[model samples]
Target: MNRDLREFRRLERLCLEQAALSTMDLARTGLLKVADDCRAAAEAIEARSPPRGAFAGAVQALKRAPLAWRVGARS
Candidate 1:
């Protein structure tokens, strides 16, 4: 992975970790938003780069994942 992509992925991971530890719903939501932004940056970088191996397929699957899960939708 390139420097920018790697950094974005790292930030995403950190944000997710923080969200997991968050006690307040609002804080967790904000952290998740940051994580999503980092993921978007990584995706943009990937979109511009040529597809590689299994990683490329994983990225495609993530894109197809349900929006409800990402947004934590509740009934």
Candidate 2:
């Protein structure tokens, strides 16, 4: 799960660098928050869908966050 999260985060960063994703997009599409939401998301995602497990977990949790980290990110 941790490895999956790391890869997810890497891809998220990649998107940010490319300016293709906003903070909301990161929280939604990448399904992640590196600093605070990581652990809870990992566990919840694993519990709900063990088949995709880590990947799905990350995406699920990412969908739930407020995305307060980047205000006006799309602008």
Candidate 3:
């Protein structure tokens, strides 16, 4: 699960960066799909109850991650 979340974050960052530089429509579309997959993975992890408060908080933060991140804005 942790690995999945980590991968999601990594992919999210990569997608955002690529989106910021991508001028081609096909590349942008592909990045959008990758972003969507990352969100879905995060949502799936958020559905589980973490055993520790810190883990719970992390999960919540992941769930609450701002839209700006997807658009390459610092948040």
Tens digits of lDDT, candidate 3, 22-72: 999999989988987887777667566464788778767775676437656
Alpha-carbon local distance difference test for all models: 0.86, 0.52, 0.77
TM values, all candidates: 0.67, 0.30, 0.61
Estimate the Cα RMSD of every predicted model relative to the unseen true structure. Answer: 4.8, 11.6, 6.3
Which is the leading candidate under TM-score?
Answer: 1
- Top lDDT model: 1
Candidate 2 weakest ten by summed lDDT: 31-40
Please report how far candidate 3 places residue 7 from its true position, in Å. Answer: 1.1
What's the best-to-worst order under lDDT? 1, 3, 2
TM-score of 3: 0.61
The residue pairs in collision within model 3 are: none
Superior candidate under lDDT, 1 versus 3: 1
- Whole-model lDDT, candidate 2? 0.52
lDDT of 3 at 21: 90
lDDT of 1: 0.86
